[model samples]
Target: METGAVDEASIDSLTDFYLGCGVDGMTILGIMGEANKLTGEEARAVASRILKRVDGRVPVVVGVSSPGLDNLSSLARFAMDEGAAGVMVAPTPGPAVEDRVRGYFHQVCEALGPDVPICLQDYPQTTGVPISVETILTLTRDCPQIVMLKHEDAPGLRKVSAVRNRSGTSETPRLSILCGNGGLYLPQELARGADGAMTGFAYPEMLVEVVATHQAGDVERAEDVFDAYLPILRYEQQPGYGLAVRKAVLKHRGAIACAATRAPGPRLDATDEAELMRLIARTEDKVKELSHGS
Candidate 1:
């Protein structure tokens, strides 16, 4: 959930909802989670609060990406002390070539030390710094701390295939690849070779089910389930505005106290809310139809 002046009761409510949905883990302070909009104290308080509530029920991963490695390491250390399973870092946006990117992360890994497992977030769309497949592979090869990849490159199916193929053929330590385009291409990502999804769709149960269903070897059934939620997924993929849509849906579902984001974040006007509700209604009916084997 987006951090704000929301009280403890609301935090507990949101945590309960996500727990009920059976998410393998929770990622706090992510891009969708509005990490940038939060004050440092607020971010730490939010992380510590969620960690306490979750209480080892599931692993909690924190996003510690920052402009300076010291800030990243500080946040990472605090999260680790707070019992985070890992911390995620994406390459900072700027004019960066592959070697420069690699060098930056190399410094990041060194600063974080080997004790902290890292999730290399590869969302080029947001960062505006594209990480080539080779760079990712090289990082995995060299950085023993990198334990997972949050792959969110659009038109990224081939990248998934390339990474997986390289993993199979090479001697590098294997990294778990989780796609993050709001689960839009979930079916195809799984087909191409994603281990699972780390994207935020309001209904995380959908992502959990899609991954489970696809991995069960029933691709057709998986696609059916995916197609049902595709509309809302697409609607929620609107760049800067999507977080509001997600928060609104969660609020509508009674999982949060307010759909309002921090100031400077997008607000859903009546028209936007109506359109979102309409898509949500259609998604519900479609999900029900699939469940009934129609």
Candidate 2:
């Protein structure tokens, strides 16, 4: 940000870079995009800017999660109005009992009305709201608006199986399962019947490649390619420090001008920076070798 303002040029360039990476769709205002830091107005404005730049080039899902339902509704409405493909809603944290979890989403569905498509953000590790497989099934079954699931629960392969098994054969429509948690277990998730990945990995090209290669019926080759990028991908998943590494890599790749993390965000130290450079170089070499072999 120049003088604490949203940098439209940087965002435009980043959006272009994201498209260049051959991503099927984009999800703005998610955890990796620092949606939580922005106020409701700022979030909507940024969403508008991103959507305008995207201009229907690819499907964009905006995260409209807020503590207040009113703020969430307004952002969702604003985003959809600005041409967002869908909106992602993460449940509020704390001991949100199963029924309340279901009820909260029910209220959200009612508030947003029927036109908007909803992607349930089920990152229990972050949201502190552990929605059971049954609750998720019920939500998808009962709520026709909730069309997608951002499945991020660790050891969630069974949950994916349950959703896929029930929803595919039952009267309910299909629920698109896009696995997250930094794409750490993507191969397994895909095997467990996830439709695709929806994580914010620094190297989305690798994520896209792995999913595409797997979808092409070449699982072994996909893992081989994923292994080439694992060092950098794993390095970029360091809990609180991941976003810093992501922006730093993007800056290094010339996709963004600044690696500066927004306020109250993590920045890499000199040691971290040096290690990231090494990983980038090594990943490039491995990818080149794989391409030659192929």
Candidate 3:
């Protein structure tokens, strides 16, 4: 959210909100942080400020995906030197062939080197490059530096299972598989062997609860929590307009100061606001009902 300027106070306030929500890590400048819109210096500054404010309370993952590998490596190094836990990278955007996608990640491993752990972001819908399960296994086997996978392939529940099965059977080191896609398929992904979620949803507590409940072996209760918030989750998953909606919800919940986006963003009209508030009200009631065991 922009308040005519980017200031430390707003950043700290946001950090406080997420920290309060009990996130294990914070990812900045990814698709949700408007990474593509930020200039290099601005991205670095935001990363530095958040790293400083967080003060080692939790791990911070910086998005270092860039069109040029040099730019990507530089940002990754900067973030690591500034004490970030690790960096996340996605395949370059294009209709890339599968072999080319595998080659790109091999280059990525060389660029990031072995010291810096990597989270391979397999967000096909956004990146237009799909990394198949076999390719992922090969990469992780070849490059032990790959420590995590941000799996967001649509209708990819079976893919999750396949990866986990391979990891269990193959001699390659296992990568932590975290689901994204606004957490829309989180329940199924988790059931299919995903480790957790890496989404930018405004209600992180719900994600935490769902993962925790499911992991606790109470699948029905996990779905109860997920179902309570699914309406708002779906409403906030609108492709081009999702970020604005997320910022608005965060502002409404007092996580940030404003819902303003930088340039080239959509504004919520009265009707949009009315629709969102209605969903919010319904979500609140549903959550309450679930909490009361109704």
Q: Pick the TM-score winner.
A: 2
In model 2, which runs have C-alpha deviations exceeding 4 angstroms?
A: 2-4
Residues 119-150, candidate 3: write the lDDT tens digits: 99998888888888888998889888888999
What C-alpha lDDT do the candidate models reach, one value each? 0.88, 0.88, 0.87
List TM-score per model, in order: 0.96, 0.97, 0.96
* lDDT for each residue of candidate 2 in 182-236, tens digit (9 for 90 to 100): 8888888888889898988767898899999999999999899888988888888
Give the CA lDDT, 0 to 100, for residue 56 in model 2: 94
RMSD of each: 1.8, 1.2, 1.4
Clashes in model 3: which pairs? none
Kindly indicate the candidate among 2 and 3 with the higher lDDT: 2
Supply the TM-score for candidate 2.
0.97
The candidate 3 region of ten consecutive residues with least summed lDDT is 1-10
Worst 10 residues of 1 by lDDT: 1-10
